[model samples]
Structures are given as C-alpha cells and as structure tokens.
Target chain A: MYRQKYLFLLPGLLVLVAIILFPLLFTIRVSFSSWDVYNPGLNWIGGENYGRLWEDARYWQALGRLTLLSVTTVLIQYVLGFALALMVWRDLAARRLFRVLFLIPMMTTPVVMSVLWRTIFHESLGPLNPILESLGIGAAPWLSSAGWAFAAVVMVEVWQWTPFMFLLLLAGLLSLPNEPYLAAKIDGAGPVRTFFSVTFPMLGAISVGAILIRLIEASKIMETVYVLTSGGPGTSTETSSYYIYIRGMRDFQIGYSAALSLTYLIIMIVALTVIAKLLVRALVKDAA
Target chain B: MLKITDLELLVGSVAHLAAINASFQPGTLTTILGRTGAGKTTLMRAIAGLIAPDRGQILLDGTGWTRLPPWKRPVAMVTQQFINYPHLNVRDNVAFPLVRAGVAKADAAARAEAALARVGLAAMVDRRPSALSGGQQQRVAIARALVKKAPVLLLDEPFVNLDYNLREAFRKDLVDLLAVETGTVVLYASTDPREALQMGDQIVLLADGRIVQSGSPRDVFANPASLTAASVVNDPPINPIPFHQNGVADFGALGQQAITLPSGAYTLGLRASDIRAGGPHQARVTLTEVTGSETLTHLSLNGLDLVMQEKSVVLRSPGDVVGVHLDLHKGLVFGADGQRAGV
Candidate 1:
C-alpha cells in the first residue's frame, strides 16, 4: 500500500525533480566554475568566485540596501496592515467596503503601481510636487535625490503590498473564536488590553505568514525599483535581485552570475530558517 | 447584586416579540425556563448588556446600568456553546478576566487556580479545552465566571451537554458555589424542567417572549399558572383535559364520560405521577412502557390520552381495560382565560 502511494505520487515527483531539483543542483555545480556563456563548459576556478564575492564592495552595499528595505518594509507593512484589519474586523458596517477597497491595491500589478507612483513623484509639476509647492513647502526631488529615491521606492512597495498582509491578518482575526474577547469583557478588560492580550497572541500564525511572504517579496523587489528608479542616482535603490539582473543577464557572465545567485539563495534560506525557528519558539512559549 | 426591572427587549422587527417585564432581587438564583424560540436567551442577553433592552432598567446595587456595554456591566455570561478559548489552557481561560482587570499576573493565576479547584478542574489547569471532556470544558467555563467574580452570573444552558451524573453533580456544585458567593446572582436558562427544579430559587416560565409564570419552583410545580406552564414543568406534561361551562371537564374518547368540575369552561390538570389505578374511574390501558425504574402507562379515558406512572406493576397489558383514578385534590385547574382557576 505504501509502495502504491509512492507510485501514485511518482508523476508529481518527476516534475519536481525535472523543474526544481535538477536545476538547483546544476546551478550549484556551475557556480563553482568559470563556465562562460560562449564556451558552455565548466573550467574550475574553485573558491575564486566566492573570494571575489566577499571582496566586492558593490555586492556588500547591495546586500545592505536589501536588508534595510526588507526589514523596514516588513515591519511597517505588518503594523499598518494589522491595524487596518483590526479596524475593519471590529466594524461590521465598514468591513465589506474596506475589504474591497484595501484589496484593490493588491490586485493591481506591482509594476503598474510603481509606474503610477513614479508619475505621481515626478520632479516638476507632478500632482504631489505642485500641491507641495502650493502649500508653501519647497518641492523636493522625489526620485532624483539618492535618499529620496530610496524612500520613494520603499513607500511604493509598502502601498502595493500592505493589503496582502491586511487580507491574511483579517482572515486570522475573523477565524479566531469569540470567547476570549467575551471573557476579556467579563473580566473588566477595556478594548486596548483585549487587543494586545487576547487578539494579538491568537493572530500569531497569520503574522508569521504575513512577515514571511513580505520578506520574500521585499528581497526580490526588482520590478518596482526597476520601473520607478532604475537602480537610481547611485546604487541607492539597487536590491540584490537588481544586482543579480545587472551582473548575470545584462553583463551575460553566466557562471559568475549563477555563483552570485546561489550565494543569494543560500542567504535567503538561512534567513528564512532562522526567522521560522524564532517565530515557532516565541509562539510555543506564548502558548505555554 | 443585580436587579432588572420592567426589562423590555425589542429586537428591531416587531413591537411585542422581544418584550420581557420582570424585577429580580439581588443574590437569588433565577432559572429562566423556556422552549426554543421563546426568548429566554434574549432576555438573559439583554440583562447581561450583550443586547440593549428597548425599554427597561438594569441596576446593580441601585447603580444605573442602562447604558453600560457588556465590559462595563459587571456581569459574566456562559453561553450554551461552552465557548472557552481553545487556544488558551484552562488556567489562562479561567484567569482571563483577572488579567484583563489589571490584577497582578501571580494574583490572577492564584485566583484562577482557586476557581478551577472550585469547579473540580484543578488537575486539568494547564490543558487546553480540546484536551478536556465535555463536563470538564463546562467546568472551565464556570471557572471563568467564578474567577471573574462578577456580581451577576448568566448561564445559557451551561450544563446542557453533560451526562446525567455529571449534570447532577455539577448542578449541586453550582448551587453550593452560588450559595457561598453572597453578592452573586445566578440567572441560568434551561429547557429541562428537572434542572430548574433542582437549581432554581425563582423560576420564570417563558413562552413567545412573555413570562407565563414566575414564582418559587415548588409553587410553579404544585400550581402551574397555565396549561403551557404545567406542560413545560413536567416530564410527560400535565394532562390537560378540555372541558366546558357545565362544570364538566370532558376527557373525550375511552368513554366520553363527563367529569364534573367545580365551575366554568375549565380544564383539569393531572400530572402523570398523580394518576393512580386504584380509585373509582376506569380507563382502558392503551400501552405500558417500562423505562427502568418507572413504568409509563398510557391510557384512554374520557376521550383523552392520559399518561400515568406505575412502579413496575404487573396488573395491566396492552388493550387491557382497567379501572383508574386521578387524585383531584392535587390536580390544577385552568379557566378559559388560561390563568390558574383560583387566581
């Protein structure tokens, strides 16, 4: 019976091996050698690519920017999305309206949203700039200045994705059993205490899910940055994905790019594992 | 320490469907007995401040509670579902109110443990509700109420799901628990008359959003105000034989014999337990069913179905015509207006 079950899963297993497993192994193998695009044969240079990656200041800067963007965006989006979901969850009259309105941003293409944001942030007579100027504040270059460009990308990313977290957290909120809230009320707990103690702890799984999804999206934040800033004024808005795009695809250093991609994959795996462990630990302790 | 006066609750649709008028004194256990859709649960919810009564006043120790939300009402309600938080352990679920009340964590835990111990769930304190039995979960819900130590304890079928023994034990424990708490007023709702008989100090019988009868349990049982109240308070129900204005209560089939009453278009109510086979009247035995300790004898007499209890007597069988007697002194009489005949 167990053998038959394995046989039943054989086709899916084969597809997974063909599409994912084989390619991952091939990429790891290729990343170690100096296999050029033209030659297409492995010429082993061993640890040279790894050593070069360690010494690259541009790579370090990209990693730093990626970390900052992912961390800040994840935190901000989690807070804002959770708050909006809680508000919507509490109010029956506005729940459907706000759900539709908030989810509208998530349904739109991220690239399209980024382009719209870019137009809105245009330096000279954009809607926001004129409004700012009319309001007696000097219009600052939103996407032209290095710091402002990074900030602009972060804002666009948050706006496009906060609704994703909102949907998940709202589902989590709705799925929670109503007893704790009633128990809290009977205990003389005001709304604030009920939210922090009863509501937040119960929403732990959804929060973890939201953060994981946001982290992955934030790490691969290429399309929005590519459209809005195009790695901007300097490499200020350049994420690891953008860096990989420039080095591997644009420069066509296939083997070197594959090596860099593998390194990024390892980092992603490590971070996600650590985060999952920490989250499970905290949740278990809280449950205890 | 709770009093509800002229409590009228109208739930938006109609003027009369949700109206409840009653005044309950403090520290008394009142059981609101009703069938499904009779608005007993609605009345309790209104008093607990879960639903606002359209026209009434809820007072706690002479303080106005008309506008208070459930959180501000100083009342705790255990719903029929035994809705304890599944994510929380028994201790935390019990201690939930104290934690919310800004008590120190240690103090709250202590009180919660004591409450759990009171409900006989101390050994299962750290277990989640899913891990517990049905009776244990109900105990946890009661522990939540006890730990809250709220002045008014409202229970909507809290013991509905327990087995017979557990229900009996829990009912006794609940009575004792309520007795020890001086300021606590327990308002329990049950469809079962047996539960109301055992636990209620004051019994309010409801039907179609109106209180048909509200009095002490013994008074309600001994002299039910209406045929409906009588039926609701007994197992096989008080057999109501319809009669007419000639001072004759007609029980129509077995012989269509006229049972002369005191006066008017009155009905005679004979409880199944009060019906005996020894006296002068005769009834054809229609069926006899033995339910362990008691035998339920169904009979056809005076054109009505009369159910009576006999203690395993081997005197009758199906279709055996036998002479039976109803103890009229213990019978309740209801007049044409549906009120108790004497009242």
Candidate 2:
C-alpha cells in the first residue's frame, strides 16, 4: 500500500519540480536540438551547437573575462567590506546610522544602481571625473575607454556588493565572545596583532562563506554590464552571462544559447566545488 | 605589593564598586569572598585594567595602572567561564600569551607543555579546546594563565562551572600548582565561604559593593564585621532573627532569655549548627534535607522559621515536633546597624 503520509509532500515536491527541475531538464533537452528564429521547432541536431560553441573564441574569451572580473571585484569587495565592518563594529559614534548608510548600496535595486553608476561614469558630464580633476588627478575617459570602462564596471560591482560581505562579517564579529579579546589584551597584544591573531582567524569560516556567495553572484555579471559599457569599446567588459544573453536573446540562437548556459552551469558547479574545498582547507583549521 | 586606594566605579548610578580600598602582599592568595553580584568581578576587572575607576589609584609596586590598557598591564586572569581559544589547540592556547609577549614560539611551546603537565593535561596538548571535557577546558584556561606567570593573577571563580567531583579535585590541583609560584600575588574570587576559608591565606569579605571585612580567614570567621558578612560566610545560610529587647531578648518558641543588657532592638545571626536536638523548647519540623552525611532540618517555632543542623542523617518529616537546644555561646549577635556586637 502506498503510504498516505507521503501525499502531504506532494505540494512542495510539485513546486520544486515546476520552479527548478523542469527548466533545467528542458534546457538540457533543448541543447541537443537546433532551435532558432527561423527553425523554431525542436529539431534534433545532436551535439552540433555544443561543437560550435567549443571552437568559438568569443565564448571562451568571455569566460576568461568573467573569471578575471568576478575574482578581482569579489576580492576587492572582501577587503573593503572587512575594513568597513571592523570600523563600525564597536565604539564608533553614530554606529547605527553608519551601519544603515553602509548597507544602502546593497539595499538598492541592481539595475537602478548600475544606471546611477553609468551616469557617474559619463566622461564629460559626470560628477566623478570633475571631482577627480579637482583633486589634481588627470581625468581619463571612463565609459569611452576600455581600461577605465572595465574599472568602472568593477567599481560599480564593488560599491553595490561590498555591503553583503560587510553584513556577514559584522554579524560574525558581533557573535564572538568577549573573552578572547580580553585574553589577547592581557597577553599584551597590540591592536594590529590582535586583529591578525584573534579577529581575522576567528572570522575565517564566515569569510569563506561571504566570499563564495559574492563570487557566485559576481560570476553572473549582467545588469551592470548591460547598462554601463554594453560589453564595449570592443568587447572588453563582455562577461559570460552577457555573452550568453546576447546569443540567446539578441541573435535568437536558442539551441546554441541553451548549450552555452548548460556549459556555464556545469563549469560554475565544478569550479565552485574546487574553490570551496581549497578555501575551507586554507581558512578553517579542522579541514587542514 | 599591589595597592588600590579609594577605587570607585559606578555604572550609571548603580555602584558596582564603591570606595574599595584593599592591598595584597606578594605570594599571598587573598580570596575575595562574596555572593553573586557583590562587585567581586567589578573590582577584579578594574585591577586588570579592563574598566577604569572613577576615583583613586591602583598601584602595583609603584607603577600606576589606573589608566593603562589591559594589554599594557602586567596581569593574567582566569574567569568563571572555562574560556579557551576555540581556534587554537590546547598547547597553542597556553603558549599564545607568551608568544604574543615577544617570546620565541619554541620556548613558549616548551613552557606551555610543562604547564599543561602540571595541570595533568599532558596527553591532551594536541587536542582542540572544544574536544576536551569542561574540567579539561578549565584546566587549559588555568594552564594558559599560569604560563603567563604575570605578577598579578586574578582567578574569578575559575572552577564554578564544573561538577562537584571535578571542582573538589581541581581545587586540590590548583593549590598544588599555585604553591610553587611563590612570588606571584594571586587574587582568587569565590562565592562559597568554605572554599574561601579553605583556600585563602587571607579573606576580604565583600557585600553590596563594599568591603565589609579583611583579615586572615580565621580572624574574619571569628569576628564577622557585619551581620551581612557573617551570613554570607555561613554555609546552609545563617538564620537572621530580629529581637525586641526589654531587659529580655525574644527567642520565639525557644523561650525568652534575660540578658545583662539594656537595648532597644538588635539582630541575632545564628548558624544551623548552633541549634542542637533535645532541650526544654520544641520546634516543629517543616522540612528536612540530607546533604552528604549531615541533615539540615527546617523548623517553625512560635511563628519564626529556624534551621537546625545535625551531624548524622536524620529524616524527620513535616509536622514532627522535636526538642531543640540553643547554643547561645556559638551564636553571632549584631547591633541594629548590622555591625557585629560582643556578647
């Protein structure tokens, strides 16, 4: 007899299948077919789209670019976030106001934040270049030039996402016991030594967690690139997600985009798994 | 010698430590005896430089440590909670202080190892603090404190969290371990009076953020400065009775006694041991408790609650009337102001 108790799980199971499993299964099936604007039906063309994307230099180049952009941005975010979190963790005047102000960027919608950043990056008419010029630093082309444009994208990512890291690290800091700090103080450790010996090491597992979450979110960089650089002055700011968006939506290559997406998903899973192992080994002592 | 003069600390109008004047000579372990929330921790924290005193000075061998940060002060403290570094192993946890104080890692490790062995935790040196038992973790904390060998060692009820057997055993081990450090001026805080009397070279009685008495353990015990101090230092708690005097002091159902004194009002503090079974007066047993080999029986005599202690275990149920003898000579007497008075 079928257990009547399992009927209760059906609603939740159905929702999971509809929201998650179905799309993933459908995308996998669609990847093997050659579907496009003209060839709208799911006509089988086994592995042809995958074969083409493997040789496509643009896809690989975009993957490499995405890797550089996310890693650099996430690392910068981690450092800046940790510094900010520590600054407001204790004994600061107007601490609550500062905490709220620090989280404002993360609280904003990503597309809106990107648009605001894009306006700031406007070379001739923006507030940023004028301020930089006023500070005796020569103004470079922000959105027009490749290097500055990439920098601008990285800047936006860091400014918008650093709060997530800060929040996690600060929570970790708050939960820490007062005894270790007391012990450190009695041990005659200065502030810097205490940070390295006690605070930083104590926040290790949380650091890894914040970094991983940021990295995963950062790897799928789309809205900021779409608004600011549009992958360009010659594809310099084009990330993997943006490239996939173009292939799927702009050019209408459904089968090819599906293949690209599945590849990206698999690569992210494998890469993140390896990265997690390496990070846990380095940060957490028990894993070592 | 470590001296504290007129040290006062107020936490927003509540006096945490008020006018606390005390001193400790080298090698003497003075137990700051008090009940919980009696400013024992506040006083110790002030000495450790964790909290600043609002008034007066803390001088350790002519060095003013009132404004100095805890890290800059030459001190080591073990708290009531068994706190050890969660990230570090037992060995590293012990060696951390020495290493941070500019000692070489290898030298610190060797010393830490020796200290661990002294605390009977030699086998668990490589294990993390989380992996150890509560007693073991506390021993690690003690080992860490000892490894520092700082001149001023403040132990704030270090074995409070342990079980009875572990606490008893750890106290003996601590005494043995601490005996070797002859130059170290150790200050131990304990709420238990018996522990204070047993462990302290001297006892400083604290009540309501004030030092009620300070003397040798026997001196403090023999002459309690205040009724509050007397009651605090008594085990099974002292029975405090207020007497209305009119050439005779009221003793409730134990009967009034004519005393050679002229008094308006006075309080008599009596221990459970002062009341013996078999006498002219009778008290009804309200409750009976057997702790170890002794029996503590609660009684109601003429609408007054009293306690009688027996050396042997005797189970007397509720409503059972028993004849009790009042040992007046052993009972402590106090004035209306709670100050101890001569019988």
Best by lDDT: 2
Residues B52-171, model 2: lDDT tens digits: 889989999988899998898989999988787888899999999999888999999999999999999999999999999999999999999999989999999999999878898999
lDDT of 1 by residue, B1-343 (tens): 5666666766567543344556666678899998888887887777777677788787877898888877887888887777787667889888888887788989999999999998888798889988998888888988888778777888898888787788888889888888877777888999988889888989999887888888999999887878889988887778877655354455443223345446567777779988887766778898888765678889998677999987775546888887787765567778877777855
Docking class of 1: medium
Residue-level lDDT of model 2, residues A177-213, one tens digit each, is 8878888887788799999988988888999999999
Off by over 4 Å in 1: A1-10, A36-40, A283-288, B12-26, B245-263, B277-292, B295-303, B311-324
Interface RMSD after interface superposition, model 1: 2.2
Q: Candidate 1 lDDT, tens digit per residue, A1-288?
A: 666777888899999999999999998888888776675677787878788888878887998999999999888999999989988987569679988999888899888888899999999847988998889997988998999999898898889899999999999998988877766766677788778777887887778878988898788889998999999878888988899889888877777878889999999999988987787667543434
lDDT of 1: 0.81
Docking class of 2: medium
